[model samples]
Target: MTLWLCQLVTSLQSCLQNKIYDGKTLTCTQTFENPMCLTFSHHCFLPSWLFVKFDVSFIVHLWHVFLNVHIKQALNFSDTYVVHVNVFVSLQVIKVYNEDNTSRAVEVPTDITARDICQLFVLKNHCIDDHSWTLFEHLTHLSIERIIEDHESVMEVLSGWAMDTDSRLYFRKNYAKYEFFNKPLDFFPDHMVSISSETNGMMNHSQLIQTFLNSSTCPEIHGHLHAKEQGRKSWKKFYFVLRRSGLYFSNKGTSKEPRHLQFIAEFSDGDVYTLLSARKMHGAPTDYGFCVKSTKRGSPRDLKLLCADDEQTRTCWVTAMRLFKYGMQLYQNFIQPHQKQKTPMRSISENSLVAMDFSGHKSRVIENPSEALSVAVEEGLSWRVASHSLFLYVSFRLVPNEHHHGCPVCFAALHMAQPWFHSKLSRDEAHRLITQQGLIDGVFLLRDSQSNPNTFVLSLCHTQRIKHFQILPVDEEGELFYSLDDGHTRFADLIQLVEFYQLNRGVLPCKLKHHCARITL
Candidate 1:
């Protein structure tokens, strides 16, 4: 206490002398020239003079009174002193880049990650609730960059940077990030989810998950689960194994035999969900418990609430159930996320795309294919310079055949139809198709709108997600040009714009590649 009090007032006299803080009083020696003699005022006596005359007890009593009145007023908030203290905070400014290259400053938390921050902006902007947004990490100093995986924290990525200030994170659409939820065929192979016709009719469900895991597969899924009693109130635990066929519990001890193992539930027409706050809400053993609820419009009592030992076990069981139920859709939802991030701005080189004019009427790639072959076959790829409507083309490499009957459209690339290089496509079907692919960046195609046939829409990928940008028709002095960036960028025709974006990087990561084409021999 003695030491603390001494240190407390160590700078009191000096601060009071210079008036650093308000409301404090000080007495100083009289100011004068060097030759002038000093004089003591009668009103303010020296400390020695006052102390020498008073008894020790009287001095202590006076000191107590002085501290009581003055200290309370000076220190207490209810008194005249309203102290405003400044706190120091170490903040790092992170610039968030939008689809249009516009940016906003995000006050990122120390524990923030790419996915968390993206969701923050999504909520703030009132964007769509699709879980396809992604964060792109760019190291300007090192001339290299990569996607910040959903599991990777932003701080962790920053820590690996060579230059702190120069490094940047790009947030944009990445449908592939969650495309598997829509495209199931690209993920689950035939043998993985199929019941073999040659094998015994009696299937061992344990071997189902093992086969999926062992294959050089489209998706990785496996985990442990607990099977509970059918009674909703009377709960009991039984260790179980989840497979594509259904949920099974080991009667003896982790038994794989059909006799020892018993079937519990199959998710063919159902879904599974993890129960939140199970300890309080459902009286579960652990809060990390889940249930496989049938979707057959049954009573809530029919649902089986199974509890896992921990979060990992619960998560594994739930994810595997979803895979078994939805199969390849989930895998397709998160496909080609790393390599297929296709923001319009991060696209191919700008000079590579070529624009053309479509005139005021409907455009066609080739009016007649047989006549074109005998006349000018290359005319089908014409760069129309019509004074009214416009056309464009992005560079595309035509592979003779892409994995058998599958076209690039099956994987979110360009769509081609003779006499109509680009046409209209339903948004749902487009989403279902793009997500089926790996969600490659710069994967784009042009199509007319169902509501407005006069104008067109450009569907493309950025950050592995598909975004539809409107292509508005503009008539400037008898000249027609289609624009997607609100006239910030324009093209003579839809084909020209498509061609331009393919070879050039115009708001897209790479040039156009895969296109649907038909040939007659």
Candidate 2:
């Protein structure tokens, strides 16, 4: 059956050649060694004849050429290119030593910080510091020493940067949640539902507090304070209340927000639990020093918890963030793309991944092959094709959109001359033209010959349709040229400019509406 099928197809090359655009039947004509057919049918029916009479070899060659063209279209030079985006920034905020505070943005790794971002804030009167105190102040919680010295009792408690003798023994006996009223914080989502009225329909804050407090031997409060203040303030108010109720209240204060309040509480509990257990046996005041202690089970390891339930404990922790060594390696790694996973290195890389190369016109295929997958990446580039005849080179450098900026295309065009295909406009000339005309760089208004404003089609060389063309300057140099769109300036810039003016003159007036100079990536 397969042999007959091959033979049948082999005789159809002649019919296929004559039926290149035929929308009728499955035209099978073999003109060369290649046995193929171009089928166009509305119904499920084979051709009337089983085979065609043509040079099968010639047909095969044509098929190969066609296949190659399709494959090239699929993976050759890019109609869409990659933009080299880079997000190198930093943040500048005034440092008030009043209290140790941990902010989400501050806690993030340094590479995620961009100099430009920092500068922006700095320009707006924010303090920008690039010193060791700033970096270390944010990364000390993950220290190995602290982790080793904690002695928590439950699974949740044990994991709180300490060793847990009771938890270790309890795990050996009972590992169920309900069996011990203990649950891991990791078990819950970052965002959780809450039903407590005191928390304004938020989760039970007191339960979270108790859980962390019980895990450690002592209660701690942490946060920042002015330079005049001292370290670690005891919650005298809560202490008296607990004392009157015959309960021990060790609250530590911290500058970390409510989210970290839990972690600090739990960590403090583990250490405090161990120390209190030991001190109780030794009949000591428990407040002898700021360190860890052992447990009743006689674990040789010294375990201590800093209770940061109050502002003081929180302050200490915040201070710790500042003390932490700037993890340059980890910070850089996180900010950059994971090369092994083929993820972008930086936000800029992901953003600038889309681009084009129109230096010449040989129908260049889309550049970035990965772009075929429709992912929510950054809008990398915007191409503005010239409509008439002038060809001008425009370049721009843009910050994020949140910075309140607009497009730079029209501003670059105002001073550019026409018949641009052969103009000799220089970068200085173009700059002078726009600056002298006092044209704002980014706004545009496209129009047609009827003297009415409208969008024009800018097409590629081989394109027969009048489609709006998009052009992005491929040159990286922060310079470009412009000339008259008419035949007078025939410079390179003039060629593109002329083409643009002849086709869409209406785009001129409103060019200054919200224009900004183009930012070259």
Candidate 3:
């Protein structure tokens, strides 16, 4: 190969020295003595005119071709061998907005799923992977939004949007995305469920989801819903029935006869979306509004608008529709995170930690199970007491005058720094924030009481509805403290109160699992 390349270089140099040039162009058809020239005739040509047009770059390119041929022949390679590889990658740039309307541009593959994108952002933002992160498709023109399922291909979802439409993808936490899997009874109320009247309307709670997943069995959800008239502002209440085929309404008052049923919409060609402003924008009778939006249409006039009496009823209908549409795929998405979690290996730090009893002069490991449990309980209590004492001391130092009308100054200094505390926020605003974040069981935020200036309120979501509990300022032994259970449970400040409720349910419906966060990214 080296000798052949050297001979080729010598031939090129000779061709360059003996080149004939006309006024119009330079031309040289130099022939070589090498026998391999006949084998690679196309690449072995000595064209001096190429140097005039493309310069040395063209000559270098031909030299590489000759070298490749030489190597191929020496190694007994096939004639159809390729020297260079061309790779084509399918990548797309997408912008995902947050609840605050701030967006971050992400470069993803065309086949990327919504769950994969959520995992990417979760890793990029250094967030905990609690499996509640969700992606939303928001249509600004229609004032409608829907939760993009975890298994859905994001590129496919983007392909359905009109080029001129004001549509966006949002990344946020939606704890209720899979809450139906945990609490099926709450989602499918007894009155709303109609399982074909078989077995005399007696179905086990455990078997409720099985009915939806089984193709042989048909589970129908029947209820009364207020539907908006097309191209009109008035809404009329009707008895609606949801099935695997499509949504239907009874034209003759709750009758399930085929003659009385009128088809409304189908799930295969559209999706369910929660309306942004039910009353103000769409003239909904109540705020608990949802709609079936056709994938082909981007206008509000095409929407099959629906309104429910309350949040739970709306949630039930929406969850049932999702189940009817996706079937077992939704269940698989709910358990996918759990399936990915491998059995945790014992860590070195955990192995080093031992339950020890230090009450005696010499500390020893508690080998007995009962002894270890007792020790753990005692240590927990001691730690709680120590922390409480430290908090009280700090509060006293911050506010020396304990009798100064509710300790507003000290309370402001401590709780204002916490992310969960939203001081002076109104009741409506608190409800909006909690609803915007998620309507999961434990999502909550702390805000000042709207009616009383001195007191604060804990706005929390239990079962798809936001409930408030006032944190009254209690005067115990001439010292100021905050309590949710009248005066039974007292804390030095609001920070301690929130932390306690996070661990212990206390008077709240559920433990505070997540706080309503308004992050910039």
Candidate 4:
């Protein structure tokens, strides 16, 4: 039994020895190769340990090689990387060049219109609103978005708003071209409403305004200035009172008179003292004169007269009245005569007298009253001078044609003819004929289908063939006259002309007489 045990032990020992030196088997049997397993050799244990040490050194070198390949590449990548980019805008393309006989790099304005940059020569600057502004027609193309986006760069190009170098910057090139004007920086909404009433004629005081003080009688004075008194003053103050007795309606509706009075007082220093006025209309003619009185410290009787004489006051009033009458007479006799002779003024009334002036006067007023009525109607519907009438007659049917075939009466009267009832016009016939006849600009009264009046007047006037139009508005009794010029007029009579235009169009024009003046409350 002992000998059998010995043989078994020897076999087990040889198997263990073989497993220790065989690294491949050790690797297969365990997750971690045993580095000290080869050092446990039965015959050469120490020498085997050296080879095991060499293997460990080789594995460490290989780990370092693996790290060198990947970790070093990562570090190098981090050192060279950039996440964002930067670029500089080209300044040359945005710079402007002045047309000099010199070649200096002039800074171009970012706001420049194609028209401004393209000009070949240096020109004198004018305001953007000046008549000469038509030169930079392309300025109409700029838009608000483009302007704001480029605001930082545009300042260099133009002189500024209103300057000749400045062109409109935010209007579209197509329809409805609107120019930008600077509005008040600090706006008070309440102040705007004050102006609104005055503009719309809805204010309480508007109806009271009348042309009572004849401009001709009033001596024109420069604006009043307030100066303080240095020494003893001769007069404390001067006052004016508008009284009822001065009111007298003129024969023509053009003259206006007020029923009440407005009195204003001013100190010797030219400062306003007070406003004292009364309105009295008792259904009877009231004749009265203005009373002037003075007052001292705390007197029981508050006033003493500086000058008091009713006859002298009346005489002064009469002299002023005479001057006004003379001025009116001068205008009617001298000025009006010249105007009438220069241009024919035709006045139409509700009932027109069939005079023998234009018509040949057939014996016993021949037949066909309809045809004569039509002729008279055409004259009433045509354009006439102001001396003729004060009404505007708008009509679609105008003068008659030569054919006598298509409302020939309409053609001669209005200078335009409507086709006869029986005639048929081709699609292009009317347009071609009108253009070919050179009657495109011809003035013809358009029938306002909106009118309800049966008997109306037509006023016609033509002077030097350079026609200018005017419209006048009169009150119910035709006593008050407010006149406005036609659209073709320049800014010479801007405020008055705009008022008429606005009224005609069913709107109120801004009441600012000039841009310089504020709309008074």
Best by lDDT: 3
Tens-digit per-residue lDDT, 310-425, candidate 4: 22232233222222333333223223323646765454652464533255555344257776777767667663344123322331132345643232111122212321110232
Model 1, 470-490: lDDT tens digits are: 778765544456676778788
Better of 2 and 4 by lDDT: 2
* Model 2 C-alpha RMSD to native: 30.0
Consecutive 10-residue window with the lowest summed lDDT within model 3: 19-28
Candidate 3 wrongly placed segments (more than 4 Å): 1-87, 197-200, 345-387, 398-408, 411-414, 417-419, 502-506, 509-514
Error of 4 at 321 (Å): 60
Report how far off residue 431 is in candidate 2 (Å): 52
Tens-digit lDDT string for candidate 3 (1-521): 34445555776555434421231123223236542332322223343222222224445665555445444554465655443311122457889999768998866657778888888787668777889889999988877889999999889899989898989999888878888777788788888987866657788766888888877778888999999998899999999999989999999999999999999999998999998889998999998899998888757788999999998899889998998889899999999789868765565778998888889999898889998998888889999899767756666533456576434344335787787888878898888888877777899999878898778999999987899998998876656788999899998888889889999998888999898765555
Model 3 vs truth, CA RMSD:
13.5
lDDT of each: 0.50, 0.27, 0.78, 0.25
lDDT of 2 at 169: 14
Quote the positional error of residue 449 for candidate 1 in Å: 52
Give the residue spans of candidate 2 off by over 4 A: 1-309, 317-521
Considering lDDT, where higher is better, how would the candidates rank from best to worst? Answer: 3, 1, 2, 4
lDDT, model 3, position 321: 90
